[model samples]
Target: MESFSGPDATTSDDGPPPPSPRARSAEARRDAILTAAATAFVEHGYGATSVDDIAERLGVSKPTLYYHVGGKQELLGASFTLALDAYSDAVEDEAVSGVTGRERLHQVVQKYVEITTTVHGRCLHRVPDVELTPEVRDRLRAVKRKVDARIRDLLREGVRDGSLRSADIRMSTFAISGAMNSIAQWYAPSGKLSPEEIAERLWDSFAEGLRPR
Candidate 1:
């Protein structure tokens, strides 16, 4: 038997075909729905923002919104997942950069500041944990724990390498993370300080505190 190729098919040299117009259209609409959902949740809190509110914000009928992205619960979950994944990935990536632990921690701080200040990042803290199902909340908690462990590990590495001061790692971790996480609470896009500036300013304070005597 011989294999036959259709007119639309390509040889092995060609990369995978691009997404079909319909698939692209559907993806764009789904993104729009997610954006509207995130904005509503951030602005009004999850409990007060219903699926109907998201649908109205998107200017799409409830059925259309459901067809694209399911209900309010799913949208909220997706938004949280997006924000958390970004934060986790940023930390893990910096952890493996073959640099001093203090340097890597510096990088992680900046990334955290920039990501948490975004619209999606705000979703991570804006919506209360009670709004999520037990399963979702548990899974998110695990991710956060993993990130926290990585930060602690980096602190240890800094101590061993003599790049950071000898101190209570747990208290230091708490102080560093607690302060950085609070940025989402008061961050304003139009604020005088840019994320980079804010990151630098915060890092300066942290670096001084962690410096070797």
Candidate 2:
């Protein structure tokens, strides 16, 4: 009986097996494509950006780009999804670790502002202009609804705990969301304030009523 286990099975305790060549290649291609798309989209709005531009940036053919992403619209949608997922993850993480309702809310907002100042933020802003298919539109709307619900939950907690003044939950949720969403429009990495600073400012303004208190 021939020994089936050879040096291949011998444990030298080097480390984990390296990724397959194909897997590494695929990952590299995917990252390159996404990076190129991000740059092109930032330089040229979604409407002006084409799949060919992405392909050119990646030094790959149009078909290669299509193999990774369906088309410009799908790419745009994917970009937006990536950005929202990052922001949502940050908020979810902070909420889970926060000690109090007010602290949770503050952390969520701060993380969100930080995300909006990233390259992902530019992709998020372009989402509105992308002509998403019905399914994509529904998915995007569902994401928005989830985020809105999270904001509402935070507000409700604050009101219940007497930290936040009572107000119309629905209206307050919308107001808070709108304020955070606008960060993408004006936030810049080189701007005067960091995300943390901005978040503190926003918290102070929202919590203290911006009056002479």
Instruction: State every prediction's TM-score relative to the real structure.
Output: 0.88, 0.78
Q: Which ten residues in a row have the lowest lDDT in candidate 2?
A: 1-10
What ranges in model 2 sit over 4 Å off? 1-22, 91-95, 210-213
Query: Which one wins on lDDT?
Result: 1
Error of 1 at 95 (Å): 6.9
Return the TM-score for candidate 2, rounded to 2 decimals.
0.78
Off by over 4 Å in 1: 1-15, 93-98
RMSD to native for every prediction?
4.8, 6.0
Q: For residues 1-213, write the lDDT of model 2, one tens digit per residue.
A: 012334454454787556555657777777677767866887677778888888888788988877776688767767777776776676564445565566677777787777777776666765464366676567667777877887778777777776676358788777777887787777766889988888778778776751221
- State in Å the error of residue 209, model 2: 2.6
Tens digits of per-residue lDDT, candidate 1, 37-67, equal 9889888888899998988887889998778
Candidate 1, residue 154: the lDDT equals 81
